[model samples]
Target: MATNITWHPNLTYQERSELINQKGATIWLTGLSASGKSTIACALEQLLLKEKVTAYRLDGDNIRFGLNKDLGFSEKDRVENIRRIAEVSKLFADSCSIAVTSFISPYREDRDKARELHLNSNLKFIEVFVDVPLEVAEKRDPKGLYKKAREGVIKDFTGISAPYEAPIKPEIHIRTDLLSVEESALQIYNYLKEHNVL
Candidate 1:
C-alpha cells in the first residue's frame, strides 16, 4: 500500500549465509488439521536446534492469535493468511534461518504460490505433505476441531466443510498415521540433509 517506498538491497543471500554459518530454507508442512503437521514441525524444529541449526516454526493457530488475528476462516481470509505467512517465511529464509510453517493450507493454488515465492527468491522451498486419512485425522483431533465441524459449530473447516488438496509432488511425504512423530521429523531432517538445505 505504501507505493512511495522503494526497494532496499543490502547483503547477498550467500553473504548472509556466510555470516550465519549456514544457508536457510522454508520447510512448508501442509495437511488436514490434526494430521500431525504441528507436532512434526515442533519436533523438526527441536531436532534442527539440537544439531546447532537455527530454526523457527510458524504455527497456524499461533499466527492467528497474532499476525493474522484479523483474519477468519473464510476462503478469502484463508488465502490471505497463507500469503502473509509465506512472506514472513521468505523473510526468515533470507535471514539465514529455517522457517518451518505448519498450516493446513488446503488449496493447491495457495501452496503453489508459496512455493513460487520462495523459488523466485532463489531460496529452497521444501513442501512437506503431512499426510493422514481424513478419518484418522478426525479421530485424532486433539483440539476437538473436527468434533466442532461435525456438530456444525464450525464453518469452512478443511476436510469437512472445506476441501483439502493433497500435494502432488511434495519434496517429502509423511504418513503420520503410520509413522511416529519422531520418525516423521527425522524423515524431514534426512530430506533436508540429502538436499543440502540444512
Candidate 2:
C-alpha cells in the first residue's frame, strides 16, 4: 500500500520560500509538562507575526484534540503522536512557513527522529529545550495534570511515572525557571535571526 504513493509537487520549495519572502523551518520545543513550552511558543508566534513571518504553532493538547485525538499516553502512542506532528510540521516547512511545535516529547530518540526528518529534507530543525526543575514544573501545573498524575489518575506521565531524557546538545536551551516568557521567546527569536532562519 505504501508503494502506491508517488511524490509530486507543483512548486519547488525554493519558489515557495521566495514567494513568502522567508525560509521554511521547524522550531521544536520539548520539555516536561508545565515547563513553559506552550507559553514560549505562543510568544514566539506573536513575535514572528509582528515581523510578517509565516509562522504556525502545533501545540500538544491542541493537536490531540484533532490530529492525534486517538492517541493515548502509552509509550508507543506517544511516539506515534510525535511522528504525526513531525510529518505535518515538515509539510508546513516545505511550504515556506515556520512550524513551531510544543510537545513534552520525553525521549531522546523520538526527538532525534524528528530532527532527522527535517535534515533529510534540507530544512532547518531547531530544537529548543525548555529547562525547568521537576519541582518547579509541579508547582506551576496550570492544568492540574501533575496533581492528577500524582493521584494515580494519569499513567505514563512524563517526569512523574515516565521519563524525560534531556537533550544533550539542543539548538537552544531556555531555563524557564530563571527566564520570563518574553525573555525565553526572544532568545528563540534571536536564534532564528542569527541562524538566518527568519
Candidate 3:
C-alpha cells in the first residue's frame, strides 16, 4: 500500500519572512573538518538567537551517524548525503528559520545539486568557505580524523585521500587560519544582514 499526502500552497517565503520579522536563508558552510565551519556556525546561531532571529543548524557528523549512516565516502554516497541535508534545510527555511549547514561537501556538483533541489529563486545560499591550509587542518586535527587519514585508516578523507573543490565565487570566504571564531561569525552575520537575511 502507498501513503497519500495532501499538498497545500500556502504563503510564500516573503510572506513568512514578514510574519517572522526576519528573512529566510540557507547558509551553506563548506570546508574540511576542523576548518571551523561548525564552530563559526554555532557562534552565528548564538548571535542570531541573541537578536531573536530564528535559526537551525544541520551538522554533517551528527547527520552521518543517523540519516546517512548507510552512506559511505564514495562519490555517489557523498552526493546523496548532501542532497538529503539540503532538502532538510529547505524545510527549515520554509518554517522561516535560518538554516545553517556545515559539511565538507568537497564536490562542486554536489553543492550545486543542493541549490537546485531547494527551488527557492531568492534563496540566499551563502557559501562560506572555511579557508584553511591542508597542513593546518591536519595539524589541528580536533577529532584525530587527519591522523587516521594519514595512516590509511580512513578512506575518502577530504584534502587527504579525497578532493576538495574550492568555490571560485563563494558569497563569503572566511579564512579560519586568520579569523577567530567570533570574528568569522560576525563577518557572516553582517553578510546576512547586508543581504537582508536577518
Best of the candidates, TM-score: 1
> How would you encode candidate 2's per-residue C-alpha lDDT over 167-196 as one tens digit per residue?
999999999999999999999999999989
lDDT of 2: 0.94
Q: What TM-score does prediction 3 earn?
A: 0.92
* CA error at residue 190 for candidate 1, angstroms: 0.5
Query: What Cα-based lDDT does every candidate model obtain?
Result: 0.94, 0.94, 0.86
lDDT value for candidate 1?
0.94
TM for every model, in the order presented, reads 0.98, 0.97, 0.92
Give the per-residue lDDT of model 3 (tens digit) for 38-153: 99989998998899998988896678888889999899899889888988888887777899899999998888877766654556677888889988888899899999998999
Q: Report residue 191 deviation for candidate 2 (angstroms).
A: 0.6
**RMSD to true structure for each model, in Å:** 0.8, 1.0, 2.1
The predicted structure with the larger lDDT, 2 or 3, is 2
Give the Å error, residue 140, model 1.
Answer: 0.8
Off by over 4 Å in 3: 1-6, 119-121
Tell me the TM-score of model 2.
0.97
Q: Given candidate 2, what's the lDDT at residue 144? A: 98
Which window of ten consecutive residues has the lowest lDDT sum in model 3?
Answer: 116-125
